[model samples]
Target chain A: MMILGPAHASPENIATMRELMGLDHSIPVQFIHYMGQLLKGDLGYSYHAGSPVSQELLRRFPATFELTTFAFVLMVLCSLPLGVVSGYYRNKTPDNVISVFTVMGLSMPTFWFGLLLIYIFFYKLGLAPPPMGRLSPDVAFPPRVTGLLLVDTLLNGDLKAFLSAFHQLILPGVTLAFFNLAIIVRTLKADLIETLEEDYIRTARAMGIGVKKVLLRHAFRNALLPTVTMIGAIYGSLLGGAVLTEVVFSWPGVGMYAVQSIRYLDYAGLQGFIIFYVIIFALITLLVDISYRWIDPRVQLD
Target chain B: MKEVLLEIRNLQTHFKTDEGEARAVNGVDLKVPKGETLGLVGESGCGKSVTALSIMRLVPEPPGRIIGGEIIFDGQDILKLREAEMRRMRGNTLSMIFQEPMTAMNPVYRIGSQMAEVIQLHQKVSKKEAMDRALDMLHKVGIPDPKQRLREYPHQISGGMRQRVLIAMALSSHPKMVIADEPTTALDVTIQAQILDLMNQLKEEMGTSNLLITHDLGVIFEMAQWVAVMYAGKIVEYAAVSDLFSQPLHPYTTGLMNSIPQIDQPVPKDKMLRSIPGMVPSLFDLLEGCTFQDRCNHVFDRCRREEPGLADLGSGHMVRCWLHG
Candidate 1:
């Protein structure tokens, strides 16, 4: 209300804003009216986009989803192997080296990391495409099949557009993945160390099962339970925390949309964005809870 | 005479802790002949389990190491074999059953899969064939409803049942020797008797040698053909079970024998059960002479100053004390 008060100060708009706020009515009556409109999927208009808030959110949703999914994939690919190596050769030189590198990754600020990656990969080496937007001005974007440019391009069989979008995504996705990768590596290494001490591990070794087989089949699955929980939490935070990365990369995602709404005092867009974020987070949590049963039989899902 | 199946010559296992090096098994020697059970009996921390682990090469390294030893199994020094070679021998040529059956088997795996895994690891057979062999072994161990029991996890079964499954797994590959390290210690008396009976029956049927390690004198009597009494990491007495029972030469062995209350001959109300006098000495300290000198009833100046070596006393009995020397 404090943020919106100044924006609604003009005489003609003040009456309109007062009607929208239900100023003459009691709080309970206004809350029911708001909920009724919300249940009907009416999020009102976005003053900034000059369109309905839900439609604007739909336009930006795929970008954030694509970035987060790509980052999550990168995190798992990097962390799982590093974590297993650190755990399998615990207290050795390789473990020591990985520990130091993960600590550095954890401590380095995300925005700074993003800028550094842009400097090296973009400005210095020119190995990456410029992250001005999701695609270059020359290349024609494919029709919005899935709304995600990368997927839509691939679906349309436009290899050039897909390649351009993929190159644009690499920097932001890697920057978002860095911290989560560090967290997974550290957590998994600790869990693996404890699991390796289990009697079953000794039994596996005593049976003359190869070390690789013991680690992958016997130890990895048991060690993964705690790490899976960590992944869910890290993913949740990434959805909310991608604001800086989105801003730095100039990517048109829900986080950037939220920032623009806040700056322009676009109340409807902000409210809709918060709701969408919470729903995605809740769905991820539900997926993780269901997965726990499959990963470990001892986990009873009530 | 029976052919020797396994021999430990001057086996020494030590653990390096933050405090100092703990000489868990210092200069121990014993042998198990083919088709015979040799009992290595001692109290906890007397390196009975370490000796078994040493034979299997399963000791946790870094903290525990087999410093000096020749574990000759079936005429080959196993300690000299590569880790890959040793692994091939384990669960195939030589296998072990541990003490805590509850925690020994992997909890996550089903009994059938775990048993089948061992068979497939040692034998070149189809998974179906291995499962069939596993079911056969489970039936031989007297588990009820072998097929139904195979599908259950370790936690789903009782402790005694888990131990039976372990024994079944150990014998599935038909290993020539099985090292049972206090296999019945964690079980109740009835279960212990049942497991022992099953082991004895299996040994007779398969003609397999066993190194039975236990602290229970009664178990030694029931299962072991020969007994080796270990005191402070040294084998102080070695003989046939009957001979060792009738004439315990070392004071430690005598203390152990006297400690068992005779059921046929009731003790007087005023008398107490006999126990050894002193605690087992700390392995971290260097003893000048005998490790058991403080606990021996007949400790003398010679015992305090000079360590005694094992002396053959005609027949097959041997003793490691100054009196015998």
Candidate 2:
């Protein structure tokens, strides 16, 4: 009521606002009512946005999703080959360099890395688009086909706008990717080194199979089992909107929305966002479990 | 020399440690005669497995390396062969059945695929054909429901079954020589006997020479025509299995025999089963003379002065001891 009600409202006005918003009920009754509203896909009203909390969250989700997807692809692409090379040539020069970089990536704060990327790529090099909203001020909003600006612009046959959105995405996406690369790389290297020493790997080698086949077909799959668990954790943080990365880049993501809600003490918005985060974390865990079953049949996910 | 399948001469496999270079297989010489089982018997940590791994070219490098050796397989010095050539020779010309059955096959992959991979590595065959060959090998190894077993992962099967699958994989390409390094050491007693029986049957059927490395003298007597007793990285005795069992020439060989608790002649409860005194000498700091000099009951001045060369007694018996020399 303090946040949603009029500024400096009297006690009578505050009580009326509370009753109107159904906050007058007992705690248990309020919980049941909230659950009912949640089941019906109503995340209450966000007076701050002059709309439902769910609608506000839905509008912002795709922006975060697009950034997360791009960053995820980058992290996987960069880390896999790096990890494989480092692990295969363990204690060699390549492994040593990669190990140093991965250690740095892990220890550095996500926001700190984000600032460094911006300083180098944005301020000094001027290669990046201005890090603010999703697009520049003059670019007309594309049709909300997928709610992702890049796809929407391309769908609208606006190649110019698509390029702008894509250009705007790269800086933030890379920042997020660099921050999370350490986990996947570290896990992959450790697992690959250990997996290479397994008796089965020796068996594979003894079978006249080439080294590449032995590493990839035999050893790599076994290595993936442990790496999958770590990937889930990294992925969950990415999917959870990487608040630090989001804040540093000013990327219009769900993380920023939650930050704004917290700043304003938007009760319904904060509650809905927290619940959504819980769901996302749980869903990512489920995905990891499912993938484990697929990768290694011995894993009894069922 | 009945047309040796594999021969090791002056094989020196050393492992670099913080202390010094540990000579795991030092100046060893042996041969696996074609179509015959040559049992390599030794106590634990006596370089038996290391010798087998050296022959297979599967020793992990950096910490362990073949410093100097000639592993002549099919008359070619494999130590000089390119990695690609060595790889081609492995599992096709020579297969190795490792000591631990539970860990020999990848836990994640199906038995069928693992076996098919080996089959396909040597033979230019379709995936389906390779899988069929794998199923055929599984059947040949006497696995019940070979089709179902192939689809199951290594962890799904019992240890004996895993060993059977390993054996099937090793024999799928009809390798010229199979180095079975303690093939049944990890199995239960009954399972051990069964594996040995399967190995025996497979050996005769395939007509492949065997380098069966084991500590069990009974297994040697049952399966091997000839036996080489290794003690601290060197073979102390090489003889026909019957001759060695009848008259163990080296003191280490005699000690090994005396330690076996005979089922027919159980000792009285008051008397303990005999055991060899003293530990195997550290490979890093071996004695200047015989490796077993410190432990040998018949250690003499000459034994202390110099290590005895393997002296060839008549009837194909060789002993590395001063008494025999």
Give the lowest summed-lDDT range of ten residues in model 2 chain B.
B266-275
Regions more than 4 Å wrong, model 1? A1-8, A23-55, A266-268
Candidate 1, position A169, lDDT: 90
Clashing pairs in 1: none
lDDT of 2 by residue, B101-141 (tens): 99889888788888888898899999999999999999999
lDDT over C-alpha atoms for residue B6 of model 2: 83
What would the DockQ be for model 2? 0.80
The sequence of per-residue lDDT tens digits that candidate 1 reaches over residues B1-325 is: 4889998899999999999999999999898999999999999999899898889898988789999978889989999999989989888879888888988877677888988888999999999999999999999999999999989888888889999998899998898999998999999999999999999999999999999999999999999899999988889999999999999999999999889999888886877688898789999995889889989899999988989998889777989999889
* Candidate 2: residue A120 lDDT (0-100): 91
lDDT of each: 0.88, 0.88
Instruction: Categorize the docking of model 1.
Output: medium
Q: Model 2, retained fraction of real contacts?
A: 0.88
Put down candidate 1 lDDT per residue, A195-242, tens digits, no spaces. 988877877776677779889888898899899999998887666437
